[model samples]
Target: MRPVVFDGQFGWLHPAAGPHGVVLCYPFGYDALCTYRGMRRLAERLAARGIAVLRFDYPGTGDSAGDASEPGRWRAWIDSITKAVALLRQSTGVERVSLCGLRLGGTLAALAAQQLGDVDGLVLLSPVLSGKNYQRELRAGYRQWLSMPAAMDCTPEPDTDEFVEAYGFRLYREALENLRAVDLRRDAAAPARRVLMLDSLDAARVDALAAHYREQGIEVERRGFDEYSKFMMESLDSEIPRAAFESVENWLAAGSGELATAARDADTHLSADDPQGHAVEAGVTETPVWIDGGRMFGIYCMPHASLVTTGGTPAVLMVNTGAVSRIGNARLGVRFARRLARQGIASLRVDLGGLGDSQPSLDTVTLDALYAQDGANDAACAARWLAARGHPGVVLLGICAGAYVGLYAGSREPAVTGAVLVNLQKFTWRNICDETGKPTVRVAAIGSTRSYLRSMCEPRKWLRVVKGQTGGWPVARELAARCASRLRATLADRIERITGLELGASEERRPFAALDARGVPTRLLYGVLDDGVEELEKYFGVRGARLRRLRRVKVSFREHMDHAILSASAQENVMSYFEDFYRSQFGEQPGAVADEPADSRDAGRSGRRARAAQWLARQARAFRLSGEA
Candidate 1:
């Protein structure tokens, strides 16, 4: 790796041998050094094709200097990236410069490209189009924390400040405010800049932004990828997929003539079917719409069926994995959203603050880095996104972790009218055993050591010693203690202090308290064969109907569906229940079509009763074989 520093922003710059020009690459969030490995491979591949690559980090992110918590740091970060691009041109003696960015970096690159006229081409991989949603996510997150009774006392629990997760940096308000001002739509049209947009399934907002560029007569090409590459969130043996690299390489190799033709052709298709195309109902075409959350990078779908003419549709905002992009979950969320949309009910599929093409994970960095509060944030963001697009009512339809986030967010945010928790895990004790089947308590201990040391090393160390020891075990028990004691010692207290923020049995029970206090409507659905079903039932019982207003049901599926809505059979069953629930609540629309009419009719006639009988049969079979309950 060729380590290079430009204006205090450090990164690796790979120069092509007798290069055609330089391409500056910016990665999402705290993924500075790690991002380069993929770009380096691309650089070499592109260099062989005659292009140099420059990859760097913004200040306060990655290995770059400055605290990410400072005000106006995002602008400064953009400025730093722009400067680095210039430096690459100067250092490489190249006249033309191409810019490439992933997620928020893509938005930043577009903004910078607008200001820097020297840019030749721009490659935006899932660019965030709004910043306001990103801010709402931050506020919603704070609300989630505050909503947890006595959770936000504002008293600093020692070493509970910093957290790092797969998403990115974990600064509370600092990153949030900075990200709230970025607007890619405003900067979409860069004069004389050739733009290439790479999208996965969740590219509605970005595609819309790209369409704006095309309308401005800017050269733009949009490419869709089939696979989900978690390069930004996790370190893989390979970073950028071969297909993505090949596509970009082909686009670059063709030169301006082919590029211009490609752009025009792509724009032609985009215009014909406006990337944000709405579902057709009753021979009327509705525009699929998105609500921008300013700099916060929150984007939500607003279906046309929810219009007043549709007699007020029942809506659901689908939530998914914190680490996975909204695009990756599109197969499930889109399927459900379309199904709901087809039923004369609306569904808003939202990209949580940091995930997807919304914004850098730094923008809404959570304390646990999991957006432990994102479910609430997502609910609020979805509502805001919907209200902005003129939808009056919305609910939550979440699966697995998405269900948890939706439930948490729905409880805190009033915008959520209702929530459907599918395959919920009320209380989970994951990582119980290591690969060798040994208890993982020791491993957890070692992981907590670093936190422990940080707390002890603080100025008021002696005064905080008791807090440190009590908190230390949360970390120590979470990691493998067999690792270096030094590593264990380093994380000990900090891990405890941070883990201390976690909702214990009592704290976890508070949502039920808030539900009782607020009287929110909730529906909990679980597969009986699924793990943790008993625990979830207990949770619902503990919270009780007063707070939760919960109606719980256990689906009698013979096989366990491992969370992702992966099985077609499982998906069909879940969708059927969702459609029925939505229809019952919102009433049927004039000309809404059912995706699975045969299944719907069959389900309506005898599905539930038949499933019940099957469950009984299984129970009888087990009893006869084992002679036990």
Candidate 2:
């Protein structure tokens, strides 16, 4: 699979083992965010099964060129599918192409297939049968998530037909209007010669839709997809629905005949004014490059005019936040990177090995592994990649798990002179399990404690507690825990002041101390009420005030900034801070100089050897810190 950009969109083109290929249409909004990795896995599975695949981001979303505020996104999404189909056919020389879509993706695929008029096959996995109902679902999901502990307070948008939103993604008036009038069964035609529809447990709509297609003389094989519930979970832990995915693979394989082996997938690279980069927007060109000996992937967003001479401006290196990929939790990485490019600064948003599009080196990659120093090694590799390409320095910035990796990478990589850690939850790992037997993210576990605290402040909830309806033990337990943590921090601070040694809840301070020792400028940002704030207070005092002793390290909290940076306004706030920081660190504007030639062999032996040593060193330190804690 290779990254290809066409029509101002980012897509992956999987070379065909045979002549048949398929275009995968993924879900929209929050569904799109959760199903990203699952969709990528599906495409790989189909490609491995002798069918080529092209999976892409729509123009206004993901790593694509536009913003969600742009109008006509509904048509833009459907048209994106149409263009992807043409690209697949042109590049892979596959005359027989099929469409596989999940949720709203299914709706778009069917519509695209109808537009194409000669699609070979279609696979719809629980597609939205009505736009009206989907809007309701989106609202319900938004409300539910808004109540989660990680959710932050913000002024609410008006409830009107002009907009529909959930989980930081929104549909403009134009898109909402389109969905409002949509009745797939009535408006859409039977899109392919062979159709396979996988429906959810609710079968009424699926049956009716199948019957409607049958009325048009189309053969439809519709079945229950009980695995849907598990498959469409949050990206961090979404299980691949092997049963459903295999069902599609077998269905497509059953009808596939002789297939051509020649592939045009490699030759469709976007040519820019500078042959080295692909122009993704007005002044910025995004080139997808492989790092760590092609074992990891990253998108290099560069300003065409920014010249990188010796000791040039430090490029920004971004890593995955949890398992959501380099696009960031809410596609924040893409927006931020492009904004930086426009400011004459280059940025690389990367997927470390085993996360995002990066190849998983282990048989099973756990969240623990994602937060390990090995991930920091991947970030170090990206920094080196940037360095060899004339960027001798980098400012590593990341959120959540990425923040932890950034701090570790900065500690080891001399080129990383500056770091920005956002909403960092953990500095040390101790594999604790939740009730479900999965290694619990500290943020999730801490959320309950915060919720119980808030309940005491709520009149209704407190009244119930007085009536013995709500348990007091839980509240008392939570308060005791909070008091104990604060006492420990207070004691640790006094001990450190008396002697040069740290104690109690002080493990989280080691990374910052390491960065400070090297005089590496670092900034830490957290939401005022983020779960990580407790850890911050435990280590550095309220709002990280005690960090003044660390001359190079500064911490600040944002108003209503959620841990995930889920909202557009919150994202903008971070971007604004970054821009100010960049200007202060670099200059008002970087003066253009002659471009230096890129390294001949970035993934060469010497580079790999250096990266390996760095990884080993960092991992040793990490192990020591964990042992000490």
Candidate 3:
């Protein structure tokens, strides 16, 4: 499958060498993110079954171009489905096109079928019939989430009539009103086509939806398929619903027409010159590549620059941010990479060793097990690969844990000339002791309870405190534990230094200290509301004096932005920082470098930690068990 652009939408095209084609629409918000891998797997499966498949992000979502927070996002998304179907036909020369969607995606598919008379079939999985009901569920989920201990650090805004946030997504009044008016059960007249409705929760709504289609003289089939959640859940181990997907394949095959021999002739290559994966814009190319000895996957982006191509364009490497894949939160990586390409720069947004497409099943270590270690190795490998591709002066850029990894990687790799670390929580991760006395590596939670408590000192937060909306005991216990942990580490470091003995390697392996010593120029960017701000002050001395004195480190902040940089405007702010960093790092003329042997260190995780770190495989699945942002 390859990336494609039509109108202003971004999608992946899976050529099947078949006559039938499918357009897979994804669900909205975090659901779409969590189900991204599953969607891709399903598309590949359908393609193998002799059906051309196109899965894409709607306008304002994923790598697609638009502001999701805007009022008309729903209408734009519905229109995007038609464009996708048309593009699939035009690209593959397929005579028939079908729509397959999950959750809200299914609802949008039904809406698209209503608008476009050419749709041949519909596959709706856990489709939302009533937009009002879905909105209620979203609000409830948001409220339930806010009640969790992990949410205590985040501030809640006053109830508003104009807007509301849920599961890291926002809904404006206009969008809410538009959705509330969606009731396919009563308002939608089914298109004349075969329809398959599969329900994971065994809800009566699917049955009703099917009946409505049948009443409209459309052939409808309904099935109870509860395993679909496995395909949409947040866990990396979550596999595509094999039985459910096979059922869809069989149903589609039942109506299969003459096969298209030209489908196999379609182009889907990873070369910079390949035009198959051009982004929505006219001058940007998106190439999917497998690097790091073919153990890692990434998308390389560069400007067309047909007028004047250069071999020495500066490159940027963006690692996976948290567990949100290489796209970064809110598809920040894609937007930034494409923008940089237009400025005569190249970028590679890659999934880390065991995150996103680089599944744990493909490797011995899971994301959590490799999080604190493999970053340096993976990033160094990426830098070397970029160097070989002619863009030798590479800058490392990442957010959250990605930031931590970039810092360590840039410090260790000679190819990395500069670094942009955003919302860096900690310089070192913790190693927990197991029963066998061996250490197990794991990512540490960011910020402290005391920092959260101090944040509550704001007048607005005090109002919430007075209203008793806070969980007092959990906060107190967490605060005490964090203070105790810090004190213990401080005393341990002092004792080890005075006695000339090693207590632990955590304090000894500070990446900032090493980066500062090397005089590597680094930029630190943080969101105003991010907890990492507190971590920055605690680790880098008062006002970051320890690093600022190096005269190579710079710090800046984005106002009204959260830790994840979810909003479009916030993402734009992030892009600006990326542009400035790349310009400053790679603006100079080319320089000759000395040829030297690469580091001989083992790039994989150490075996000593592997046995003890077994539990981390499960921990990475419940990735935010300790923290969300």
Candidate 4:
């Protein structure tokens, strides 16, 4: 599968020539993000089974070219499905096309099939039968997430009458209204010649939808989506329902012709040279690039023809946030990149080697490769890409694990002129690889664990802790020990700062010291009670006061902060801060790097990295099917 863009929507095209092609419609909002990797695996399977497939992000979502707040997004979403169907047919030259969708995507698929009037088949897996009911579920889910004791400190206030949220994604008022109006039972023609329905929670709605299809004399096959609960979840642990997928594949394959070997052979080594970007907005364009020799992937968003184009302004580099891909949690990365473009800055958001669209699974990647101190080689590739693209330098921004990667990569990469760290949990990670070469990943405490511990004062919380609610009691003990060392560490930090020298061993100050030598401006933002702040207080005084000793270091603690930028207000807060920060540092008239010719040396380095990456991309790598926890 290769990345593609059509009608300003980004998608992966699993190319093959067969009697049938598939357009896999993704559910809206966070569900789409959760199922991203699984959907990719499905597409790969379908393609291997001799069926071409195009799985896409709807407009205003994912890697597509728009913002979530735009009015009439629901209409645009339906239209996007229609567009995807056409693109798949045109690209694959298959007379028959099937629409397979999960959750809200399933709803969209049925609707789009009806619109097309000639779709061969429709598969709805745990689909939303009624828009109004789906909206109610969203509200319920939002309430449950907020009510969790662990989320109390970071809970967001949603307007009871106005807001509809799904984890980090929220629907706008008009869009919510549009969603409520979708009632599939109301005299809609059967969407396709044949239909497969995978029912999960709401049997009544599924039965109603099935009856509606039967009324129109459409052949319908209804089955239980037995694995739905585990399959539809946060990506890291979301199971890929292999049995459910097999049923759909068999159904689609029953009447489909074999894929033409000639066409399949022709697709080898897809010409991945930076595809031209469609206009994102009036002055900005986003081109999807397979950089690092095609071994890595990123969406390069650039600001065009800016009066703010001052020399020496660096582009921005956004890495994966935690285990999430290039889009970032709640699509903050895409939102922020476009926001920067409006401010006359360019940015590239990359999925590091083992995350996002990048091939290797997190299960296979060593802890040392992604989370540890010296594990930012992939980001180094992106920085080099930016430098060769004519950017004098780049500013690295990351949240969570990303922050750790950015801080280390920025300090080391010569082209990095600035670094932005948000809710950085730990300054270092412990890596222990086994003799078999597969790293035994010893992950540090994530925010959820810390949140659980913070509430351990309660008896119920202590019971849960004792029962090993935190994976194991050993982790809890380790956290307690770290907490206890704070006083000694803080005292040591004070002595070292006053003397302008290391007290004994190097601490968090090492990276900043290196960055300081290169005149890199570093900014650290944190929530008041965040786990990362404890380290800051221990090493640089409470709220990073002694951080001032490193002339280039600046820190901010915001009241409306969450470990993940989950809420609308939190996202607004971070974007506003970055805007002001950029203007203050780069001046209002500053410009990002441009597409000027790269020096031979810089080009050579970029070329080598790109070549290596591309070569790696050529090797056949298998994707997860059943999934692992």
The prediction achieving the highest lDDT against the true structure is 2
* Alpha carbon lDDT at 283, candidate 3: 79
Query: Could you give candidate 4's per-residue lDDT for residues 448-537 as a string of tens digits?
Result: 333555566578756775687745566667667665665566576667757766653366778888898898878887765566766665
Give per-model CA RMSD: 21.4, 10.2, 10.7, 11.7
Instruction: Score candidate 1 by lDDT.
Output: 0.50
- Give the Cα RMSD of candidate 2: 10.2
Q: Model 3: per-residue lDDT, tens digit, 1-629?
A: 55677776766788977889989988887677777767777776788778999998787666666667766787888889988888999998888888998888988898888889878899988887777787777778778765543344345544686766665666678777877798876555775389988896637777777788888899988887778766666534455677788888888877776544434523353343332454546677776676754567688887776722455665889998766777776567877887777777788898877676653323122344435677778888888888878775688888877888898898888788788888777666664545542346533343434346556677876677678886556666756765565555556545654785544433624665567677667778776546675565454432242343344566665554556665545566677766755655555422211111112012124475653454254235222222111
Spell out the clash pairs found in candidate 4. Answer: 293-610, 293-613, 293-614, 295-613, 310-591
Cα lDDT of all candidates, in order? 0.50, 0.76, 0.68, 0.74
**TM-scores of the models, in the order given:** 0.41, 0.87, 0.72, 0.83
lDDT of 1 by residue, 72-151 (tens): 67578668867987778787775577777776677778778888876778887765555555444434544453333112
Report the C-alpha lDDT of model 2 over 79-154, residue by residue, as the tens digit: 9999999999898888688999999888889888888888989999999877778888888887887777777443
Error of 4 at 439 (Å): 12
How would you order the candidates by lDDT, starting with the best? 2, 4, 3, 1
Off by over 4 Å in 2: 258-276, 306-311, 361-365, 432-437, 440-445, 448-452, 467-469, 498-501, 504-507, 588-629
Clashes of 1: 50
Model 3 worst lDDT run, 10 consecutive residues: 592-601
Of the two candidates 2 and 4, the one with more favorable TM-score, higher being better, is 2
